[model samples]
Target: MRHIKEYDGLRGLMALWVLVGHWAATIYIQFPWPANLGNAYAVDVFVILSGFAIATLVERKRETYGIYITRRVLRIFPVYWFYLAISIALAWVSVDMWTNAAGGEATSNRLQISIAALDNFWPNVISHVVALHGAVPRNMVPNGEYAFLGQAWSISLEWQFYLIAPLVIALGVRAASSFKAGLVLVLGLFVLSYISPRFPYSFIGRYSAFFAIGIATYFLVNVGIPFLTQRRIVIAPIAMLIVTALILLQLPSVLPVSIWIVATASVLVPSQFGLSAIAGLLRWKPVQALGQMSYSVYLSHMAVLVLAMLVLEKAGITSTYLHAALLLIITLAGTLIISIASYNFIEVPFQRLGRNLATRPQAAE
Candidate 1:
């Protein structure tokens, strides 16, 4: 638990990657940088990190199940509910205006906002709240000017992944004796995710392959990849952050393909049995910090964008580009502040609640 602080860096960094992906996409509407960097894979990276982190947190081999679930709830739900508070409240206030912005849909109806009609709201509240929309055909990401609201879809996916992955992990512990069991479980989940379109494993499929990668990575890292643990290796999420920035931001001219490619590469690159520079970067400091609050950053970023745009609109500026640029600045600043603050207040507190509330010590855990 004490060393978990080290993982915090990855969480913040991955979360930031997600934020950058979102911000990049928003800018792409005006700037056109490589064009493929905007998919939810950066969020996928975050999911991987979440799975990796939770694997460490709840492994029955490592800790008791009751303490594990309680700790997980404390870690995941409070800030989640708090952010939901932020989203619901912001959604409430902006509903009319946002509805007006949508123009094609009913503007003032709570039913519309709450219901989130497929054609109009994209999976509505039920799927959104439960993180099930990705299982079906609904576009989990937003379309065009509708970008801000779509960010929540990843949160939904993350939430659902959190719920189901533990069960899969626990199964591995019961079914097998070693990390090999975990690998089978993770690969099985990956196979499930790969075939999700046909079978519909959970509420969504965006996280299928990504979550599996995280699980596998956990085994590889924590259990040591055959001989790697003998050498005491690590991923360095902060380094990943820096490399991600350089490749995605500083040198896109030199760096072609897309963030989508990069994200997939993030997963695949690790599997290569050689020296890993990018993985080392992912384990970097600044990158790690962004990864830590990445969850809060993902969940709350859209609201920040929406709020920023609204503020810009009220400030008498209506140009889409200007609004977007201003929105980016404001949203980035606001999202970072909120993410850090929430991590400290809501996220940290709740994530730690189980520690304080636990009936036993290490034994309870």
Candidate 2:
């Protein structure tokens, strides 16, 4: 399938946004306006983009299920497993530190360490190991560290989507002949979202609407939407405005996820209209490079932030603003460096392997 550089840029921007959001939450650094938008919103963008990317791939390549699955596994698992190992090691050290720091004194750290290991650690580990944590309620450790990879909950959700995408694509393809059938499918997804609140950790139920929006966008783009086909100057500003609104409002609880879905679609669909000046910005070499390493950045940034915080505390950095700034700088710089290495060493090799295996005639079968 052909590459979509603009989408790559979007992924890079979203990854950076997630890093910023984590910094805000972890260190209490409040940024002004657009920067303050919740990272959860960025995650929704990721979910939508994932659906779009997968749909586009299936539509364009028409690859066999085996090949599709292999491609996805290679794209996701190598970096994921690498980061998981690091997180596990970090958790081990954290537990030891907490135990030592307690030194017969009552401390939350000791309690957290005990709860993480004794109560929730094994189960959480099993869930995360199998990539089913997104579907399993009560998978989180008591201290909300999420067993050392708190951000991985979304990765788990993405894994679930990857597993089922072939079926979703098949269904979509089958329904293409009948608009009524497609509408029914879309409605079903909405119904799932409507009931998602009743089921904790129901990634599908909670995010299916966004994914549906993405799939719908793919179809719309394939067929050509006139409004989106407008000039980039017009579309780009509107998309930016939607994003800015999303940021400013912080999305009141009363608003449904569909609003964000629409906003995400607004941003993504227009960029595909045609390569314009705006697209040029997104396709800049550095931006595309960042996008290429986005997966690694996403998986590794939280761990980097946590480790940095621990080191900062050890160094007696008590100012919140200073801590926040230092954490941001360290996390961004460290994550970029680590991601660059990971992309070169882990991601590219596995990707090439997956491609080689998928292209083999017998493997495709």
Leading candidate by lDDT? 2
Off by over 4 Å in 1: 1-10, 24-36, 92-149, 173-195, 198-206, 224-285, 318-321, 358-365
lDDT of 1 by residue, 213-316 (tens): 55665665456444653565534443356556667666532232233233333443455433244456656777777766777787788678667756765787
Candidate 2, residues 1-365: lDDT per residue as tens digits?
A: 24667778878878888888766655544456443356777777788788888888788767788788889888898898899878877876665544443121222443374356445767777777776766764434443325567677788778888888767766787787978767866877777777766544536777776676677767766654555566334444564465567677885421324333333343455344353555666678998899889999999997787677678768887777777789789998999999999999999999999878767875567
lDDT of 1: 0.56
Q: Candidates' lDDT values, in order?
A: 0.56, 0.70
Runs in model 2 lying further than 4 Å from the true structure: 28-36, 92-118, 139-145, 178-191, 226-277, 362-365
Clashing pairs in 2: none
Cα displacement (Å) at residue 256, model 1: 15
- Report the CA-based lDDT of candidate 2 relative to the real structure: 0.70
Candidate 2, position 347, lDDT: 98
Q: What's the true lDDT of residue 132 in model 2?
A: 72
